[model samples]
Target: MITKEALERVRGWFAGRLPEDWRAAPADITVDREEITVRLTIPDVDLPADTAEAEADEARAGRAKAFREETREQRMKIAQEAQHRYERKVSWGVSVGGREELWTHVSAPVMTRLRQPQRLVLDTLVEAGVARSRSEALAWCVRLVGQHEDEWLGELREAMGHVADVRRKGPAA
Candidate 1:
């Protein structure tokens, strides 16, 4: 859970820095700055209702079994498959819009002077629909930090330079 103040500062940074085009997309985007977490809801897959409860309960009482022996193996297999799938899908990039949304979720401390560039990247990703929201983009960013680290760092550096220019130019004089 990010502190309230940290969240406010990051939002302030966005409010002060984000470009109009990027901000124009619906502002309903939410960010949690402390945990460096962003949350977006996607439609969840519906699970089938269990219909064998009664029979299973009777069998459980007679057998005194507390767990499914077969389920353990199945769970391991599913876990491995999911991990493989995640690795394969990790390359998917977020839209710029989503990247902006992600920047909104990051803390002001970590983003520092490069907040806007980070925001831009995230926003671009979101607009492209590579990620569903800021949080997802951040997650993906963190996951691929090793590969995309230089690009991200470059964006941060660029943002810092822009901020410096803004400060020096004094807001359009």
Candidate 2:
């Protein structure tokens, strides 16, 4: 987990550096032990499809091709800037938006083997109307914890780092 001070610094940096048009889109900023990541919600733009439209004439097709190429080039530069400025170890996640479904109960997937009792608890959230599905219930639980117990979470993460350091030392030290 990132320290609160680091998070604040990164947020300020992003606020100052990002262009106004890009800033209009929302971002999910997270700090793990190794890197700070930002998942930005791209603005809804008329993105070009890979397949050419049958209705488009030659001139229209040429113009659309040029426009799409320009957009792609601009996006690459933005990503390069973010990678250079923000992350220390890994790259930040950036994309042109099409993740409207993620806003709902169906969010990103995490693959983990949970005990049967834990699965039942997640199911209970669905039955109690707290979430839409097992996945949603799990996400809801995580978000609830993050909102309410950030400091504890941060301390726990720091402790885990200590544990890792100890484990790396091996026995008979």
Instruction: List the candidates' TM-scores in order.
Output: 0.23, 0.42
RMSD of 2: 11.4
Clashes of 1: 21
> Which residue pairs collide in model 2, if any?
none
Q: Taking the tens digit of each residue's C-alpha lDDT, what string does model 1 give over 102-148?
A: 22222333433438889788778788998987766766677688576
| Global local distance difference test of model 2 | 0.59
The stretch of ten residues in a row with the least summed lDDT in candidate 1 is: 88-97
Tell me how far the alpha carbon of residue 129 in candidate 2 is from the true structure, in angstroms, after superposition: 2.1
Candidate 1 regions with alpha-carbon error over 4 angstroms: 1-114, 147-173
lDDT (CA) for every model shown? 0.42, 0.59
- lDDT of candidate 1? 0.42
Best by lDDT: 2
TM-score of 2: 0.42
